[model samples]
Target: MAGIYLHIPFCKQACYYCDFHFSTSFKYKRELVDALVKEIHLQKNYLQGETIETIYFGGGTPSVLDESELNRLLAAIHANHTVASNAEITLEANPDDLDKAKVNALRKTDINRFSIGIQSFFDDDLLWMNRVHRGDEAESSVKRAQDAGFENITIDLIYGYPLLTDAKWKSNLNKAFELQVPHVSAYSMTVEPKTALASFISKKVYPPLNEQQSASQFMQLTDAMREKGFEHYEISNFCKPGHYSRHNTNYWRGVKYIGIGPSAHAYNGFTRQWNIPNNARYMQSVQQNIIPAEVEELTEENRLNEYIMTSLRTIWGLDLDRLNAIAGGSAPLLLKAARHHFDKGWISQHEKIIYLTQTGKLYADAIASDLFF
Candidate 1:
């Protein structure tokens, strides 16, 4: 089974630290949706007839689209793809966009999962992030989605920002459990170049992020979530049992997926492609039945490094047999390199499958790089 990811590139406003492709203006909204539908038809064969297991609507802000627009896109998908009857359909939504009427309308769609952006339930933190939703709305949004019968819900929380204290971070985790959200995707606040956060720090308008604070809070998050019976299934995700994100899991497992819309990416087990990040350019190309994108053929080394990078960050751990096949007899050398981390108690190997310990997870990126062939 494969997955389809649709990127919605419009937002009500820009978040302070966001560097994702998005337009805060609604000028090209209709044109962009039309382009997306056409692009779906154009790329229908990308998945090569694999049954679609998931359809994900990601963004700039997918929730910004109305019901009619969403239905039109979904209809196109059904017409062009073999979506499974029980396929998981997810829409990423912002709290302010999910009012009573909107949630009710959404329930009528095939979307069974809701990923809400509730970065924090504290007003100060919300302002720090410049999220469109207020603290009360963030809480009420989940309550509203639950009231609308969306049980397979996940909400995002941002930790390690200057405004988020340990107490506040714990409160955020507790709030997810309190609301009975089945899945939670939390992330650290990274200041990408050209983001407002980076700009602020460069001029001393905002305090620089503290690595120690981030590490401390991450440990706190894991401990607190475990107490509440949530599994840290991914390095940046926690969920109740049986509630892991199948869409993201497919990504980590190296499954093929087609990405539609501007700035979206697709991987077909070997070649990786991404659409132009600009809305106008994307629309122009799709209008003429051409997909404007760049493609890269994955070398054996590329695939091996990717497998190591993505697999090492999850609870499932990296599969040794698969790595051995791709390593071209260099697997032994790689394993030798991994022995130091194993001896350091940073990673554990169950004969072949290797998993990072809690301490190792802190240095997951570094560890993966070291193990790369």
Candidate 2:
């Protein structure tokens, strides 16, 4: 099965730490929506008639689109692709955008899941992050969605920022548990090079992120979620059984998917492509029936490294047999590279699978890179 991801590249305001491709202005919203629909038609054959089992509306903020706009995009997908009867359709939303009217409007569509951005339930922390919603709105939005009968709900939480103390982080987790959300995606705050957080740290306006604090909070999160019967399925994701995000799980398992919209990425088994990150250029090219994107043909090394990087982050361990299938004789070298980690008790083997220990997940990226060919 394949998946479809639509990137809505407009947000009402920019968060201080966000570096995703998005426009705070809506001057070209209609044009962009039209271009997205056109792109759907243009990329119809990209998935080669595979049944689309997951349709994800990710963003800058997908909730910004009204009913008509969202319907237009989904309508185009249904017309052009073979979607599954039980497809998981997810809409990424911000708390402030999910008012009563908006939630009721969404109930009219086929969106069976919601991924709400509720970074914190603290007004002071929200202000520090320059988020558009208040603490109260965050709680109320989820309740409103639940009242509207949307049960497949997930929320986003952030940790290890200057304004987020350990106590506050614990409160955030407790609040999430209290909400009875089926899924929770929590991420440590990292200062990307071009984001406001990075600039503030460089200028001494904000303190540098504490790696120790981040590590401690991650342990806290894992322990709490495990105690609450949530599966730590991925490094940054936890969910009640059978409630994982199908779209993102497909990504980790290397399923083929088509991405629509500016700065969105698509991957078939052999090649990967990403759309132009500019709004005007993407719309103009799509208007002319052209896909303004760059593509890369995968090499054997590329495939092996990609698998290593993505698979190691999940509860599913890296399959040594799969590694050797990608390129014969690759597993021995990888095992040699992983010896130090095994000696440190950071990794363990069960039959043909290599899984990260609890401590090893902290160094997952570095270990994967170290094992890369």
Candidate 3:
């Protein structure tokens, strides 16, 4: 089975730290939606007839689209592909956009799950991030969704920023627990180049991020989630039993998926491709029944490295047997490369299955790269 991700590349306003492709103008909103529907039809054969088990509406903010727009896109998919009867359909939303009326409107659609962007429950922090929603709205949005009988919910939280003190971080986690969200995805604040936050730090207008503080907060998060009976399933994701994000889990497992929209990406085991990031250009190309995208055929090394990077970050450790199946005689070289980490007690091997120790997760990316063939 495969998955489908629709990238809605429109936002009400830009977050200070976000660098994802998006436009604040609604000048081409109707045109863009039309193009997205067409792209769904055009990319119908991309997944090669794998049953779509998950459909995710991710973006700048999928909540920006109204009921008809969303349904039109979903209808296009239903017409073009074979979707699973019990497929997990997710919509990523900003808190401010999920008011009572909006929540009720969403209930009319097939969106069974929500991934709310509640970066913080602190009004000051929200302002610092240039987020349009206030702290109060974040809490209310989740409650509204629940009140409307949508229980499959997850929230996104940010940590390690200058304004997020350890005490505040703890409070944030406590609030999330109080909200009773089934899954939580928290990320450390990284000031990507060309974002507003990066410029502020470069100009000395804002203090630089503190790694020590980030590590402390991350530990705090893990400990709190574990105490609350949540499973730390991935490096930055925690969930209650059987409540993981199906779409993201499939991605980590290297399942095939087709991404529909400008700036979206798709992978089908052997090759990966991404749509053009420009709104006008994408719409124009789709008008001519063309998918303006670049493709890359995976080399053996690329496939191995991709597996190593994605698998090592999950509760499912890198499978040595699978590695050998990918390329015979590859496991011995990987084991040799992982020897130093084992000595450092950062990883442990049991019956040929390797798992990251709590300490190893702190340097997951670095360690994965080290073990890459």
- On lDDT, the candidate that comes out on top is 2
The C-alpha lDDT values of all candidates are 0.92, 0.95, 0.94
Give a tens-digit lDDT track for model 1, residues 237-296.
999999999999999999999999999999998799999999999999999999878899
Candidate 2 to truth, TM: 0.99
What's the CA error at residue 53 for candidate 3, in Å? 0.4
- Residue pairs in clash, model 1: none
> Model 2, range 276-317, lDDT digits (tens) per residue?
999999999999999888999999999999999999999998
| lDDT, model 2 | 0.95
- Residue 183 in model 2: lDDT: 100
Poorly placed runs, candidate 1 (over 4 Å): none
Pairs in steric clash, model 2: none
- The clash number for model 1 is 0
Please, what is the TM-score per model? 0.99, 0.99, 0.99
